[model samples]
Target: MKKIDERYIEVLDQFGFGLYTTTAGCNLYHDSSWGSYIVNFNGDDFVEMFIGYAETFDPNEYVSLHIKSHRVIKDIGEMLKSAKEIQILLLKVAIEFVKISKESMVKADV
Candidate 1:
């Protein structure tokens, strides 16, 4: 498993998400109750961060966001060079994704 910043975990918690490492060694943050993933991290040197969404948060109806990477840092060496940058990128996307979700939900209710 790759080592991520503590703040990344904290951010996931604040958003009611859980982190899981896939069998293929990718990182995933998801909401189990909602049966949806918020993001996925794949690749080694040039990490690919996949941003996801769950607007209504329905286990059966939510459409997930899928991407190769929201932000890509290329040509990294063996030392996990872009951890901090990746963390910030992930956090920013997560925050915006959730904000959009909240706005959509509010509009839906009106």
Candidate 2:
């Protein structure tokens, strides 16, 4: 499996996401105020991106991004098709979600 690049890690860290690599070699990022993102790799490609919060926050909430490698090029408009594309796509969505989540929390506190 292709490892997540240091540049990507840097971006995530700046966004307040803590990175943790599992013993089995999966990548997981945790954001206390939002939730966790667990990347599931299938062979040389990413098969799924799971975004989930702790039960303490919201037990009923569970979100996932299913990445069909063969369909990614068509769906995401990526000229060069590959698993690396998943990383880029996932990062963009994750960052946006974090921004939205933080905004929602701020509104709730008002």
Candidate 3:
């Protein structure tokens, strides 16, 4: 994904959405206090997720259904085929988000 800034990335532009997945997390790994995430596709390959802590820690929240460089989908079936991959990616990203937030909180206390 192309980095829009320190906190945002052009997810749609990166059709490699399904690449960052994990077995424990399908595509929706989240934490109650840290953050949440939802990486999926519709009109465009986008993400609705949050990384890091609250404004107190400068959270990185991505909530765009249609991000930059909308994909030219040739077949919906093709996308469906890779649902597992995408699911895994979502979980991985979400878990990472919560982990980062937790670590940050610990550091803040220190």
The candidate maximizing TM-score is: 3
TM-score of each: 0.35, 0.33, 0.36
Model-by-model lDDT, in order? 0.44, 0.43, 0.35
User: Which clashing pairs does model 2 show?
Assistant: none
lDDT per residue as tens, model 3, 1-110: 22223222333223333223343322423221212334322222223233321212211112122123464545444444343344454455555545555776798999
Off by over 4 Å in 1: 27-29, 32-34, 38-40, 45-110
Candidate 2 displacement at residue 34 in angstroms: 8.6
Residue 95: error of model 2 in Å? 6.7
lDDT ranking from best candidate downward: 1, 2, 3
lDDT of 1 by residue, 7-87 (tens): 556655565556666756544554332233344556542112434422212322212111133334232231132333334
Q: Pick by lDDT: which candidate is best? A: 1
* Candidate 3 positional error at 104, Å: 0.2
After superposition, which runs of candidate 3 have C-alpha atoms over 4 Å from their true positions? 1-48, 51-76
When summed lDDT is taken over every stretch of 10 residues in candidate 3, the lowest stretch is: 52-61
Cα lDDT for residue 70, candidate 1: 38
Ranking by TM-score: 3, 1, 2
